[model samples]
Target chain A: MKKAKGSVDEFTQAYMEYYSQVFSSILTKVGNAEDARDLCQEVFLIFFDKFEKIENKRAWLYGTLRNVVYRHYAKKDPGVDIDEVFNDVGLTFTNGFRDTRIIISEALEQIECGEDERTMLDLIATHNFTYGNAAGVLGLTRRQVEYKYGQLVKRILEYLNSKGIKDIAELL
Target chain B: MNTSVEQFHQLLGRYKLSRPVSPGDQEYIINSRKQDLKDLLRKKGKYSLILWIVIAIYAGIRKFGIHITMVQSKIIAGMTAVAVVSGSSTGVYQGTKYVIKAISKPPAKVEEKIDEPDSGMTIPDRRTTEEKTKEEKKKSADIKNQDLDATPLSDVPSL
Candidate 1:
């Protein structure tokens, strides 16, 4: 985290620390190693171009990464609307909690939300990002993201209760 | 509310989204980074050279006395100020482009039929050349007709 601070003389340090995580995030979103590699390179080039001006390097990188991935999807299938079609969390659940995950995933999928709402949920929940950082990545103010996340969780819990699945106390 | 949120996050922990970079991708990033940085550094060096050249030219003009001006001191000050600001603020990337154009042979111009796509496939020409030319001609003819119309307050004397 400390290495994410300065870009003046520590570009190499920043790159070494972030390159892998950025690649991984991109790979998960894009689902192709080759495309991910190219997109990751594009993100770095953009970072390089604006190296001097950007602060909160991690947030900015992730933000740019999300746009690049969305653009990649838009390019691949011109007919498909990117936000409408590719707005799922894309997180993989391990076999450990197969049934629970399946139920949860289904409930979340049933809810119709905007792209940023889903992205905010995904980043905060899976990546353990701070609300501020998640908000920054999605180009939302902190309050806006907090509100959206609250609404999202409320909707999910309501949906679950409606389906007669009160709570997964044992899983937690 | 907080407890519920905590429980939600814990549930989310069951799902995962991460992959450590493979050695191959890491190597590519490292190599490409080196090349990119080399280009950036070279551009920086070019900017430095530009600054030095400006300084040298200013010094030469001041010392030679042949480069006299209307107000020598003010002109010198103004020139130096402009030189410094321009040499600093044009950005290294643009400076590199202009410098490269200065040193390298210019490429032959080719008329492009299709504008390049932002990604993936070639861009299709949405409007035909004839359609574009027809619209342009209509615009010019309209302009000419507007100019030919005469209206004036001193109509009797002018007629």
Candidate 2:
């Protein structure tokens, strides 16, 4: 019983630290707060069940969260394209300056990097991870992370330039 | 216009700010974690039951003296295949139907085409073109033989 309490305490600590980041990641995918919350709950519950076995809790949680999002969309529509789903979420934010959100989201989809690079970008850009922290979570070197970030930014800029948006301030 | 990396990073920061999860949402997720596990287990339980039934049937047929007819055997075999292929505890009813359709259908025929050398266009069946070329060569040879036959003694003197 004491052991059980200890485990619960450990889980709660992890939950408090990573819940918002997990929730935001889900919200980005599902574009619905309620569904994102439900999925976030599911992610943590699974984490709780396998708490003792997890090494690198942040990486495991993010990996599991991504799977949950993929399975949720797959169950919802068996053949849904992920880019299309992201575009739909982008379209939902099309009020005034929110159009910049759509442009940025589209540019992200256009980039040539694989899903891991994009996830790394999300960690640094959305979850506010420092280079060292992001590298720790992603199992990448700091130099590698910086290189990926540079390439991602260059791609986004090139895409925006092609669309005649020369200055990032123009989006603002 | 020179766009600095800092400006791009700031733009991303603003996007993140726009999508913040509310405090109420955070509270709801933390509170409902146990209930979410219960729901997941319930869903998994239904599939587990189906899987157990499939395994029991297979074991019974193989070990016991129980006899199943030809059609029943095919159905059972198909169910087992679907369960294994889907790797799901729940019955893949739709997947089974697709598998049955694929198994029952006849193989499709494919037509092969060849390109004409002069016209640079595709024609059906290279064999037919080969036969046509052979016939043309034979006709040309026959015409040349007829011209040589007509030339006769005069052509012999020139030789």
Candidate 3:
């Protein structure tokens, strides 16, 4: 019983450490702060509830977070167009810049390639999420995140180069 | 390859929501022991629900008076527990679907048709267009009329 209690304590500490990162990821995806926080708590709750049943706690966590976010949106606004949320969050991001439209357009165009690459790019550049944390969040190893991030950055650069945008600074 | 580098740079500028949460904020979240308790209770409730559902199903099946061994009873209970959770999840999904469908209705725009009498039959397309135009024209005319009325007739000379 004492050993079980100790293990639970360890799980709780790990959960608290990852809470903010998980909350922010869900918030960005949902574009609503309150709902994101609630869902984040719900994720942790569900995590603890199934703690004994899961083998890879980290992977289960990421999977559960994904499912919770999906289920929340699915319930609140069925068929809520993801593109609209992206546009809204993307616009908020652009508005932070001095030259909102141009820089934003460039940023958006560059990031529009594919899911895994875009996600990797967002984690590294947008959120400043470390490769280690991002990899954990994505159920990947740090080495995998680093490897994929490099590939994604390479692909984005090629796209810009083809468009005659030689330097990233020029886009800015 | 090149596209990814550009994407990385662009994403850097797009980090609007990614601020480092203060230690105080982190502390608050960490200290919310009440929330943790509530969350635990909710899960406990769900598990209780599963247990009750299993009992209910077992009672129903056993109404037939087929005597089962202890091992058989455990297996039936386990299967019933799984069925209860699955049923609840399905209920949640279906309920959410209908709610979303109901809310997605955009408000109906009232448009008057000129080509066809404003009241009766016309293609669904033309009626909406007509109403929009009519509303615009009326709004413009109201603005112009207000402007003319605002200039007192006495200012034009007492004719």
lDDT of 2 by residue, B1-159 (tens): 124556777776666433433445444543454344345445434224443344345334522333333234446867778878777634577778889999999999898888648776666765677899999999999999999989757545552
Residues B52-119 of candidate 1 have per-residue lDDT tens digits of 34333433443342333223434566687899888787777698998998889777799879866668
- TM-score rank order: 2, 1, 3
- Model 3 per-residue lDDT at B133: 94
For candidate 3, what's the TM-score of chain A, rounded to 2 decimals? Answer: 0.47
Candidate 2 Cα errors over 4 Å, as ranges = A1-95, B1-3, B15-159
Native contacts recovered, in order, as a fraction for each? Answer: 0.15, 0.16, 0.11
Candidate 1 yields a Cα-based lDDT of 0.61
Better of 1 and 3 by lDDT: 1
* Candidate number with the higher TM-score (1 or 2): 2
Candidate 1, superposed: residue stretches over 4 Å from native? A1-24, A27-96, B15-159
Evaluate model 3: give its TM-score. Answer: 0.33
Model 2 chain B, poorest ten-residue lDDT window?
B62-71
In model 2 chain A, where is the ten-residue run with the lowest total lDDT? A1-10
Q: What is the lDDT of residue B69 in candidate 3?
A: 30
What is the DockQ score of candidate 3, to 2 decimals? 0.04
